[model samples]
Target: MTITTHSVTLDGVEQRYHVAGNGPVCLAHSGGPGIAWDYLRMRPLEEHLTMVYVEPIGTGESGRLAADTDYTLDNYVRYLHVVVEDLAAGPVALLGHSHGGFVVQKYALAHPVDALVLYDTSARTGAEFFGDAVANIQRHGQKILAAFTSQHAEMTNDELTDVLRTIMPAYFADWRVEFEPLRAAMRIWSGPSRGQDVPFDVREQLSALDVPALVVVGEDDFICGPRWAQELHRALPSSRLRVIEHCGHIAHVERPDVFYPEVLKFLS
Candidate 1:
């Protein structure tokens, strides 16, 4: 299949997206307000759907905000609105991983979407989420925990990349076996936090949503683990939950066999 890259100007900033495969259009937003979009590419799903992998603003060739602190969920959703309108594909299905899931949740509530796939993400972010993340890293080892702790807004791209690589193993169920290539391929940008001084919670509003949603999470995801996925499933009125066995945060990469089939079936 051929993959085509395109860019669109949204509110004077450039946003890039890559499209491939066939069938219905599914817009995918990668995790990490900072991670490049390449890692989220689901080649298998592409066979059955036209995958539009969004290169979210503040990463890759996409434009950056004047101040890093301006990178909030609202802005991400706003830019995403423009991208969807540019596609002219009405009510496309949306798949969001981690941070992208937060964006998708917010967007779906306000706008009309064909469907939603919330992968390894939480509907809220607060002390519990932050505490769980720290606890998980500690279980791996203090060295990684220290690397995770060292992350600061002021770090340069190279510094942030180093920290991400150092803590990458924690993101998978078994990193030593088959995740080395993905680690090497990772391109992390040092963007600002979502700029939420208060907790980010949309659980209360999710019950009102009627859009079909599939909540998928790796059985062992550290940050947004099964707890969050179950919460999402419970909150969403029209939703189903799937937890892939022997997997972590990036199930699409770590367990494609299980991930793709479930996702395709949902989309179908």
Candidate 2:
């Protein structure tokens, strides 16, 4: 991976990004409203495609704004635009994980992406998206975060696997098995924080899409389960939803053999 770092000015704010690998271009996005970028180490796929992983404004090595800066979905949309423009890759096989799914979905809807591989992602807007997020902050806002530092392994390995197991079983046909370390990295990539609540009725617009999109949902992901992926597939006429038999929220992480191969197939 020939890794390089660059800065792009967006709204007078300089945001830093990392680019690596070479092949079909993909903009890999990490989840969490304020998680660090270390969790995006998908080096295996890097061998096949150039993965441009971005650190959203105010997180990781990315620049920050005023404490009052709005991290809404619309702003994140613009942030994504600036990153893509900086890469000069007008269209890419947009790849997003978990909450990042919402970000890229907004991008593809506004622009023409070559294709999209959304792993354990959602496309609809409702209380379900924001309700649990806000409730999490209200529940464990500062107590745990205040202790967090700039460490790669934020949580114990067991703690990490235990939490992911919550939704991993639904993504595939089985569980009680070991997942890859990259999956653990992705979990750390997705901090438990929530983004600012911004609701939009994106469902009605999916059917109007003219580009190809793939929705992968774990059967166990109660939050964005098979039913959720189904709605997204229905909305986008060119979209296809594949329900991983035994996985959940972090299908790409829990079932990478299943996840990575399926993504490559979709993009191919």
lDDT of each residue in 28-143, candidate 1, tens digit only? 99987688899898889889999999898999899988778788888889889888998999999999999999999999988999999999999899888889888877888988
Q: Go through the candidates in order and give each one's C-alpha lDDT.
A: 0.89, 0.67
Clash totals, every prediction: 0, 15
Q: Write down the RMSD of candidate 1 (Cα, Å).
A: 1.2
lDDT of 2: 0.67
TM-score of each: 0.97, 0.76
Candidate 2 least-lDDT 10 residues: 143-152
User: Between which residue pairs do clashes occur in model 1?
Assistant: none
**Model 1: lDDT of residue 102:** 95
| Segments of candidate 2 deviating more than 4 angstroms | 128-196
Task: Report the alpha-carbon TM-score of model 1 versus the true structure.
Answer: 0.97
Give the number of colliding residue pairs in candidate 2: 15
Write candidate 2's Cα lDDT for 10-99 as tens digits: 878777778888788988777655555656557777878888888877676676655423666777778888888888876888887766
